[model samples]
Target chain A: MQSLVIVAHGSHLNPESSAPTYDHADTIRATGAFDEVRTGFWKEEPHFREVLRTVEGDEIYVVPLFVSEGYFTEQVIPRELRLAGWDVSEWDSDGLSADQATLVAEDIDREVHYCGPVGTHRAMTDVIVRRAESVTDDPDVGEGFGLAVVGHGTERNENSAKAIEYHADRIAERDRFDEVKALYMDEDPEVDDLPEHFESDDVVLVPLFIADGYHTQEDIPEDVGLCEDHTEGYDVPETVDGTRIWYAGAVGTEPLMADVVLERAADAGADLGTALDDVRETTRVATGD
Target chain B: MAEPTSDATDEGEASGDAPETDPEAPEIDLPADAFDAVLDALDDRDPGEPLRFEGFSVERDDEGEYVLADGDSSTPLDERDLHEELSERAPAVTDWYAFERVVGEFGPRRAFLRWIEDADGETVATRYAALAEGIERAWGELKITATVTDRGERRYDVRHADDAGVPVDELEAHEDPLDARKLVTYDEKGRYRPLKTAPSLAGGWVFPDLGPRDLYETVETIYPATVANWHREREGGLDVTHWRETMERQSGIYGVVKTWDRGEGHEHVNWVAEACCDDSQCLKRREWEYDDETDLDVDGGDGAFPCREPCSVVVSAARKWTRLESEQPRTYEFDLTPSEKEQVEAIIDAVADGRIDEIREADTKEGANRYRTRFLRAKLFDDEGNLGGVPTEPDEE
Candidate 1:
């Protein structure tokens, strides 16, 4: 009976902005894994706060459907979930117990747990590399060509770009491509400078966003000078300092994204013994009449 | 209930699946009013019903228009009050607002005057004061008002040059005439008056039509490049279907963008050039095209021009857009008193639903004409989850 809440970044302008999360929820619901699974977006209705009120589950688990572990995951989600009130510092073990007792004594004891983002799983590399390869047309062989993993880095948290770097390093270790580098929209070694920094004549830029939006279309293209004529398919064939810089599609909407969500859910369940039972108990308590 | 296997059964199965999973249980029952009618109409649904209706519920024809049991006993659904109640309560949540804005704003002005039907041309003179206040608000503090009505349709309105009722020459000479007269207005004595002069601006909102499918399709055809550009940017694949539908709906209600031929007395085929630029970086026009060999310059070079220009001009390297041609100009201009914009927005919203034909005539009888020809209709469903047709048509009124 543990209800699953999938939090997505929705937009008032585009209905498709929330499509992937909705589709994932539908697919997960079809499996009959959880009693209730619902979606809410930051920008769209049934907003994040409203999403919390939607389900009657004693044990609620939140899974953020975001591309990076940025401000939304750390600040916005926690602020909206009302879980921050009970959350003591990580080192405050005694405070944790005090909070737990307060929860237990209350008429409705709600114990909430959050799972990691879909982008964190080690298996996500497969989807990324595949999407990169699918959009890349560079025939240059071996290790000479460069792979640039572009992410929407923020100034809020210095460590926000770690996820993008981790994926980049993972791909670099494989050594299939000559050099792999992590670039960002906001910070140093910017997306536009990839062509000059790499030794290879060909550079493949992949956007690590959940959706293709303003950054991918306007900012990225303006920075890297993507060919305005080439429409459909995420290949950028613009010349930078006489080098061919190619652009890859955003990673969020990959067909394998559904598999990644399932994988993350499974991984989160591994630590909790009798997870289904835990869900059932939590739901029963949460829905107390 | 045993799960059936066909499409109809699948739909029913899906609904039942959600209810079954929940612990709560309810015994389904046929209402006394719907019992015999449901049985009789089991196979006699209208041809237009299935194509245009989705996520709508049908109840007793509340307009009391339909004949039931040989016209012996029929009760009206009171759709007027129902619509009024809905418009008052949940106007924003409903998906039908898209069409409502489109059909309602299909007139002389791209903007629609609140809920009024067939009031075009000279009729606009009646709403001069109301429109003046709206213009003041929209234009950002102008002291303008309608004065001379020579042809009745044509208006000669003037705005005070300054907040102190000064003429244009008295204000800063460098400022553009239009910019200097931001939403300011004048009273009957030609004295400058702010919001205190006219409270009509405080009232209802005005709207523009989004248009029907045909217009949307044309605009889409014209702006395929822009559509593709938007599609390329989303993580979820760009909803080409929805985009096309949006454009068609916009075009139908807003009409087409073309020039008129004074000699031929017909709308001439023309293409509108849109300059897309990001002001954050430099204004470098990205894409540009021309359909005709006319000497058109898009760039209004230097000291502040509108984001869009009515005439062709050169653009910077950052601006990206293309030219699209149409068979003829479908444009028209009509003036609304003031509240038309809000009504137009509602009408456009209704038209965008893509389920216009399903709206029942009974449900929208009061606002049917204004709602119909220009606006599109969509059906609403009951809590029990039944298909209800649209309750009104524009032509009916």
Candidate 2:
């Protein structure tokens, strides 16, 4: 039987790291499509190889629920999963990129599809804008707000900030807000610099992580002067010095992303015909009961 | 059939305790010249004219103090060798290599299904493949089904494991679940690859069914201590005593993990943590077994730290635990010594009579206390299946 293996960076301490992954897996499973839809985490239950046990037959699909196609998606995951090929080459155009097709040993007759990270999808920019736009009364006609894309940048690798930077630029090009800035948790142009970089007092901070793990929920919020750890779909509010702050939950949890997932699976030979992007209806349609 | 293993003796019918006379122990009574009364009755041959008495097949009471039946009549046989019989019947793991291979490929739970499918019905192999209690303890019921192929080989179908009401065949026909953590970017050029342990991650095998224990949670709870011990061991240069004790309490099994050749190939184990806990990543911590022989190996074999009722910890330890065929298990053998032949027969009588605990509770000797505890670890011999032989499976009520 074919199995869909979702690989996420589960948390040892943060429940948020794995909760969304579990929720999404449960939703996708409700569709009754795969013989098995299981989540394996870097940190959580059914940790990596444990999830592999559920997959017995040749058809295996591994999707990294990562925000970006960086070190983890390319090197760590492929190496750990023993994916057919090295996730070495950088990806282009987001969903279902065949650019990273890794070769397996000759004995491996199984069909394995390694898909792209969630953040690179075209539909993702919409979610980021929506998170920033949701709290405003009239986003199109009224006052334009500043938006900050908070990512886990690195001191060692400049490439670490690529996805966040890319998403921030894409949103900026749209001109929906007065200003857009890319901030990092680890490197230059940090979140602390967001206030100085944007002229507008009403700035919204959007974490571009695949899930609201320790980083998005705890780290980013702490860095942005908020006390609460807000997750996906959460429209929680915190403000400082007349600047109203809106932390849209994780962009990866956007209902639309579920549709993107289906597209990626289909592109990998799952052959789901529909091209619909109604991921928002995932939970409602996926109740399975 | 052979005699089951007890905490002490590895030898069964050849056990050293048989024909000796110990003055310190009381002698058991048997009716003289009863024409092998006890032996013949226990081996009752004719099903058509089967013997039945007192709502149980018997000729005498279980305590064996008196014969309840005469020769052609019903009565208990005297001087029965019930203890040895029980000992012979305890669960003995006969095939270690095949068992490990199955577990290595299918994890613990699925391995149980494979065992049943291979054995036709559950045998000693499948019976203990799961928790000592088996499926009832893991999922509240045992419902593994098998379809016979034209070749007469059994093909197992494991659809009931899920609550979806979907059969295995149907799921396989159209299977693709979404990754809850994030969406997978699919690449047509991707080919299948076996998962290998990342050089930098913690890694091990997965045990299938862990009875009722949730091993992940168990690992989580003990993770801090393991990490701490890892540190202590790294600095303290590996304290075998402390690490062994911690492992025994946390996971009932003991084995080792070390520098391995990933190229040699491992069976179907799913995940491999990059716990690449090299000297750089991990230290002399609690989680690491002492590199006793400094032979951290690739082959995973298991043995007890000390025989105790296993909890989920053994499964955890088994993950990193491996063994090579050359090494032998440390087994102990001794003849049942003085002051206890009386106690042994009395205890057997209590057991066969169905009042073992009562008999045990009534006795105050520290020796009797030790005996009962040891007996508890003993897997009684059962020709049918040892899953039905022990006291730990779950109370039906």
Candidate 3:
């Protein structure tokens, strides 16, 4: 039997942090692809340390539903998953880093294929572009609107901004949008500086986050002037400082993300078998099939 | 237990003596694979030896076919057909897979279900019927009810114990177990529940249908590792980090917790445990004491689950108290009447026991009542909110 374990950062304060992970797990489970689809959390129950006990399969595929290949994906996940020699303490004095590549460890009882996080996958670029296009009604919205990919960056890890910059550069190379810029929540070119960074009057801000938690729902909307009241939801195409801001939901919530997770699993050499087509047939909207 | 067996015996007598050879034997609807797994497990044991687990015993008869009996039964052994006996004795035994799953898994779910079955102290058939009728168990402040679904699968419902009688429609229903995290973050009074195991969980919400795994996950979300720790302690495997060891591991801003261990015979640790680890303060029974060697005077509480170590709330509060304890001793003199001194002590006791909320404003007879407290304040306290017109600190002049 084969299994897929989606690991995400759950929150003690907010329920929304783990919503997307559960949604994707449900969608994936409905396809009947893997024998089992389970979820683990860093801050919640069935913690990463004991998540493996829930899996009954000998061949397991673990996909981190995080937005970046930073501290969690690189160190904490591997350490907690007990992936062979990746058992070094997260706060180790030696400062050694776990391998960030698609890792497959057979040292444990099962063959655990630890895939790269879904947010860092190449398919996430399509998810970001789709999110930006989704908020507007224009058939050719990208031609005139600037796209700002908002990421929760940190000064502690430079790799936190890599996925956002990679997606931004990739989208910029496509030349479909007038401009594409990468923005961060902590680093330079913060989410609040979206207006100053974009040349287009109408700009779209797409949060490259794994969940519609405090960052996507409150912080990004308030920073872009879309949310006047913190308790209320925001509308798209809201005017912020004379610039029309079109805000999209977090990229991770997109239905296409289910496909991205499978892609990450496939990249890590998970045997999708014949069920892979069923998953794409049910979840993929971009294919227009 | 006697009631179900009597009922089964009545059904058998109603069917007559040739019940084994009766053409209309009740269908044995046990899951094929799960029964085989049970058979496989039994096969591992000695040939004639019965495998006993959670109020049920399974073994093979002389014909080499499987025979299951209630471990609690005192009846004589008979080589009856498995189908007729099972259908007559335990009609609710369709979902053997659920039993297999719970017994096969080596974790909290298995331990919890086994505990539930053993606690019932009934025959397997009677327990199955009770589960079908929805038997409720209390885990901390949560009410967990396990019911056999129409498909012969076990479905668990979890809600606050206070909301046990409330209809499902009256409460918010959750599908995912992770939603319990948000439910446990605050109390009904909208106060943040700093300790997850505190008995302040908000009610009017229920996860009315969960699988065994999801039920375990939901309970864990609400109370973290209480079940696992409880089970571990029962099995003599709980790695308890006592107050001293836990405090010594504190670093950075919380490093002051280590200073609390002044070798004063752990009297201060007893105070910390008394203030934080009580049944009223936390739902987990305090298993950790001053150290592995010394035990505290305060009771560990009658909680269903055990706390393996000092929680973050205890550590954080201990740090604050440590800093306060380091201050130089000072003496302040105040004169009060006998009743006033007793009233002050009553006020402190009321606050410490979290009974201030129970003291009604209209019940002015109570010493801690708002009107009585106000009357005392008016008669004694000065305008600076000082007790008995005495300043805590001496004037600079």
lDDT of 1 at A258: 55
DockQ of 2: 0.03
Instruction: Write the candidate numbers in order of decreasing lDDT.
Output: 3, 2, 1
Q: Write the residue-wise lDDT of candidate 3 on B209-246 in tens digits.
A: 89877888788778776776776677787767788887
Model 1 interface RMSD, in angstroms?
Answer: 20.0
Off by over 4 Å in 2: A84-87, A90-102, A105-109, A133-143, A154-156, A227-235, A275-278, A283-289, B1-111, B114-397
Off by over 4 Å in 1: A30-32, A56-59, A84-109, A136-145, A154-156, A228-244, A270-289, B1-397
- What is candidate 1's CA lDDT for residue A129? 72
lDDT tens digits, residue span A1-289, model 3:
8889999987756666777887888778877778788788776655675567556677788888987766677667786676775533422212222223433443235658777778777778987877775667453568778999988776756666887888899999999899999999887888886788888998988888888877778888877678776588766788877778898878888766888888877876777765557755655444222
User: Higher-lDDT candidate among 1 and 3?
Assistant: 3
Taking chain A by itself, what TM-score does each prediction score? 0.74, 0.78, 0.86
Q: Write the per-residue lDDT of candidate 2 for residues A184-241, one digit (tens) a residue.
A: 8887788855666778867878777777666666677766666544443233566754
Name the candidate that leads on lDDT: 3
Q: What TM-score, to 2 decimal places, does chain A of model 1 have?
A: 0.74
Candidate 1 whole-model C-alpha lDDT, 0 to 1:
0.42
Worst 10 residues of 3 chain B by lDDT: B1-10
Which is better, 2 or 3, measured by TM-score?
3
By TM-score, how accurate is candidate 3?
0.68
> Judged by lDDT relative to the true structure, which candidate is superior, 1 or 2?
2
Task: Output the lDDT of residue A2, model 3.
Answer: 82
- Worst 10-residue lDDT window, candidate 1 chain B: B1-10
